[model samples]
Target: MAIVTSKVAGHAPGQPRGGVVQMARDSWVVARRNLRRMTRIPEIVVFGLMQPVMFVLLFSYVMGGAIKVPGGGYREFLMAGIFTQTVAFAVEGASAGIADDMTKGLVDRFRSLPMARSAVLAGRTLADVVQSAFILLVLAMVALLVGWRVHQGILKALSAFLLLLLLGYAFSWIGALIGLSLRSPEAATSAGLIWLFPLTFLSNAFVPVNTMPGWLQAIAYWNPFSATVQACRKLFGNPGVDGAHAWPMQHPVAASTLWSLLILALFSWLSVRKYRNAVG
Candidate 1:
């Protein structure tokens, strides 16, 4: 009985460790694996590159003239909306990647291993941030070409960019959660876009919420996407027309940024908890 008890005690440590060091190690391994996958499939980068460009083009030329922005011209008005939509699309890559891994049974294999369970999510999330940042840079260049200027000076502009990136990172966690919970890549993709399309268009990103119907206006005003857009517009020093954009009716930048941080915290917690449970 004593020997059996001792052997059982010794076996306990053999189970996966769930501490910071182990998590860090696991995350590093996962990040490396993700980077390699990106390398092998350059299409991943291409897809990210193309999405924002298409959105900017589609909105600027196709919808820009049609859409009436209150304070600025169509290109100027289109910039905020385009940025919001672009970041929203980041979830596409995150969800798709996770679902693909799940489909390939790679995630199951990871579960069977005795590594830091959180590493998979951490690595994937970090990669998502990097990819999102790259996409943002591409979009920024395009915005410049299309006459969307950031008037907030270099320092403020950089800060705004960071905030936007953080927002994208938060949404990536949502993608990760959806990816793990869903059964198929196609299902994840569909779910992600369905969520994205409504969230973005309904907000003050492109057209002012005041232009929307009374009910939609209310929804758009409160939408986190609108907050982000309003905040970004403030940061960009864009002109504001009352009864048009609403909400950040004043300092949209600060309000939008605060909401983004809150969201990031919420989604990160949710994703981490879900990931641990899935691995366990």
Candidate 2:
């Protein structure tokens, strides 16, 4: 009776907790479930790949020479921006998927199970990261065919790509929160993209920050998206990386990492709390 009371009161001395391990295992299982679902719906992957590829091709040829970067091939500079945009777009997908699951009672089933409370959100975000990576790979190939070359060494180029994935993972947490807050997938999808247009467009993704007006330039330079784009340009040794003097643009790698990590932490906590309330 004393032992039971002690355990109940959280005074179980010397008893090892398997919460972390169990949570990880549960999260992986959820992630795999999502991945398998994606595979079954082949059009999902195909459409995801096609959108970014289309952007790459259209921007490369139609806008070729239309926008000029002072020091590098506009194509090379455009790839980083397009790549960042594509991964950041994962937030929409995450929102829609979670919203669909909730609407169809999938989340209710998970809630009734023995899995961790965080497993659903964590699993969804993890799956988004994987999907983002696969999309990035295909997009990069399209970029190469369009004359976008990575001048930096392979390792640096890889580091940039990794940062983009990190950004995607971070943003997916926000999507999780959005999906949980909304009632339907359609609403979630619309809410998911509502901010992204400003977040991506207001940043230095497609154009040089210096080209924007003074007030707008400030916002673009300070944007988390801009930080990642500038970081990628520097890592890939592409053009338009040197004009900005802001702290983020000057030290983009650090800024990008900090931004991604900050977003991940804030939204992860919010998402997990939202998940609890959603299922409570």
Candidate 3:
């Protein structure tokens, strides 16, 4: 009887277990569900894929030729900038999903189940990473067609790709915050575009920051998106904006990564707190 009782206790309901294993199990479920939904939605995939490609092709060929880099053509120098902006913008879809789920009461329904509270948020964010990765691959192919290549060998190239994905995930967290906090999907969508469009365009996405007015230059140089773009340019061995703005480009690979990680950590903390409060 005692031996049988011990076995039953070992498998008792609600018994605490491995944090990582639990997170993994929960994340897998979330990722699978989201991916399945994405696969069924052709329009979402097309738009997400098309926006980046169109921006790169149109801007690089039509407007890029006239905009000269200090030493050479501007098209090659600007690809990294465009990539950063595109990835950052991808966060909008993730934000929309979160807002949609909340508005539809799906999340509230999940709260009534016997699942981990952090699972949905963390898993959905990971799912966004997968989507961002696919977008990056497509963007890379486009860049290659446009004659952009990573001069760095396999290891550095992989690191650069990972950094870009991390940056995307971090921004996704910010999107999550907006999604969770906003009362309506329309408000969330409006706020995201309003906030992100200015942040992306005001930086060196197409033109060099030095060419802008002094105040604009200061803002652009300090912008985290600019830091990320400059870092990726170094990693890909592409020409940065200019010598005058070299300071932002210098050692950007590390600086941008640190900034990305910091922002992600902050957002994660806030999202978790907000979620727990809501649940309580």
Candidate 4:
């Protein structure tokens, strides 16, 4: 009998074959796959943009008169919040996609391949980010039709949009974890929204947190959702700027950046860990 020594089937002996470069390549492959699927199912993109467009129209027309924004009209104030809410709600799609993959046994198939484990989740979240950017573009056009303008220069406006995308990407990790834990796509969709309602509603996304009860006000000001909304408002030069005393409201850009980074770090780790144990 001849004894043969070789590296474990997929991995290199001295150094791991697939390190950061492999992860990036594999992640892009997965992202491209998901993006192609979206192109085939156009409804996903259409419906995603539709809901936010409806919100822009309904709120700008119906409640625009009732709401009072400091130094600006309600439509202007509402656009940032609308943008934030729309991006935040994008988690539903992320969760549904991941859940669908798991339910269809695609996760197991991927695990059998010699790819980085993180690629699965990273690709899913990256695909969601691309979808979100498209939605934002459509929403921005609709916002302009409804009389929302970015008074700040183009650079600032771009920054606000980038911040919204970053926030959405961070939130997608939460969806990724939910999808991994849930049994069905339907369940993942429901679970994703259960907490999102309060997170978006309770914050300054719609109304001023100062209007809430004293305790609720505290929570809203400290809420990460609120931080992003406020940052967008400031960067876009929209109205509805209250809570000058609160750290988040005062330094919203920094606050949003910190909150997004923290969420991404925490949930990405958790989701990847869950993914490692999940397929088996």
Candidate 5:
């Protein structure tokens, strides 16, 4: 019993030490594995880029003429919205990816390893972040081509993008929870987009909140999604400012930062807990 217990605890003489460092290392290995998979399947990156590029062109030409924005042309105003939407949509990919692994019995394989259990979710989310960053770079170039200029200096623009990435990271945790709970890639993919559509559309992504009905305006005004969008507009020095008296609109940067951190903490805890139960 003692020998078995020692081996199970992974504290036996020949076993690897377990700690935060080990967890990080295990996570990196898993992240690298996913990254390599992304490389082998180039369609993953190409498809991700296509949607945002289409949105950029579609809005910049088709819808740009119809929408009116304050402080800048529709192109500039649309760029920030495009940026937030792209990163926010990472939730769908995360959910589908995680669900795929679960349904494929990959979770069982990971469980058999003497590695940190949290590393599975951590590594997947990290890989999503890296992929999102690359997509963002390509989307930024597309935005520039459509005459989206950063009125604010480079530092502020960089800061805005960082906040968007942070929000994206937080969003991936929500997806992780969805994937683990659903346990089917197909269902996860559909369920992931179902919630996201309302979250993105009801907010000030494509239209100003004031244009929405009074009650609807309030909801959009206080939305965490809107907080990030507003923050990006302010930081990017673009237009489409919500003149509402809502606290989120008044102090968007702070609201966005707090909302992101809160989402990250809450969903990450829920995801890890769900992961353990799902695979246990």
Candidate 6:
């Protein structure tokens, strides 16, 4: 009887037990489910990729001539900014996805399951990260077609891409929290992007921070968005005006890393707490 009970419990002698490992496994399962839904709904991926590609063409052709980089061509300088903006804007899709799930009673369904409480939010954010990665890849191809090149070697370019993904992943947590707070997906999408307009445009994403007014330039230099953009510029060896003596612009890689980590840690905690409270 004891042997049968142990076997039924799945407590094999050499197998690892549950806890965080089980939570992660559950999260991956949920992530895969979300990915499958994205695949099934081809428009989601298609439209997501479209916005960035359009921006690349519009900026590279429409504004490319008007904007001047200090030492390099504007097309090369603009790719990092485009990459940063695209990934940062990924928060909209993340928030909308979560809010849609909530409205469809999917959260309630997941709550009824024997799964980790954090898995739902974690999985949603992970799936969004994957989506953002795909968008970045498509945008990169578009940028190359527009004559954007990474002057830095492959290693540095790869590091830049990693940083962009990390920033997007971190921002997705903020979206998760917003989605949990909102009742409808439409509301989440609007609310999610409300601040991002100023956040992305007011930063160095589309223009040189030095071109802005003195006070606005200060704010832009300190903006977390600017930090990542500047970091990518450094990594890709793209030409743009260097940041002033500001700490973030002066040491973009470290600043981007710290900012991303801080945002991820803070928002992940808040999102998980909000999810639990919402479900309860």
lDDT string, candidate 2, 37-156, tens digits: 999998988998888888888877898679888887788888999999999988898999999999999999998776788989999999999999999998888888888888889999
Better of 1 and 6 by lDDT: 6
**Each candidate's lDDT (Cα)?**
0.76, 0.89, 0.78, 0.89, 0.88, 0.88
Could you give candidate 3's per-residue lDDT for residues 1-280 as a string of tens digits? 5754665554566754648787678768877888888889868777888988998888887888788676556767878887888778756876787788889898788667666677777777888888888888888888888888777776877777888888888988887777788837788877656788889888776787877999888888778888888777777777754445446556677768887999899998898777666641
Displacement of the residue 253 alpha carbon in candidate 1, Å: 4.0
lDDT of candidate 1 vs native? Answer: 0.76
lDDT of 3: 0.78
Give the TM-score (vs. native) of candidate 3: 0.89
As for lDDT, the candidate ahead, 4 or 6, is 4
What clash pairs does model 6 have? none
CA RMSD of each candidate after superposition: 5.4, 5.8, 4.2, 4.3, 4.2, 3.8
Instruction: Count the clashes in each prediction.
Output: 3, 0, 0, 0, 0, 0
Clash-forming residue pairs, model 5: none
- Scored against the true structure, residue 22 in model 2 reaches a CA lDDT of 78
Better TM-score candidate (2, 5):
5
Question: Tens digit of lDDT per residue, candidate 5, span 1-280?
Answer: 5754654554444465689998999989988988888999999789989998998898889988998887678888888888988998889888988998999999879877888878898898899899999999999988887788888899999999999999999998899899998978999988888988789888999887777889999889888899999999998888887778899999999999999999999999999888877852
Residue-level lDDT tens digits of model 6 in 240-262: 84758999989999999999999
Q: How well does candidate 2 match the true structure, expressed as C-alpha RMSD?
A: 5.8
Worst 10 residues of 5 by lDDT: 4-13
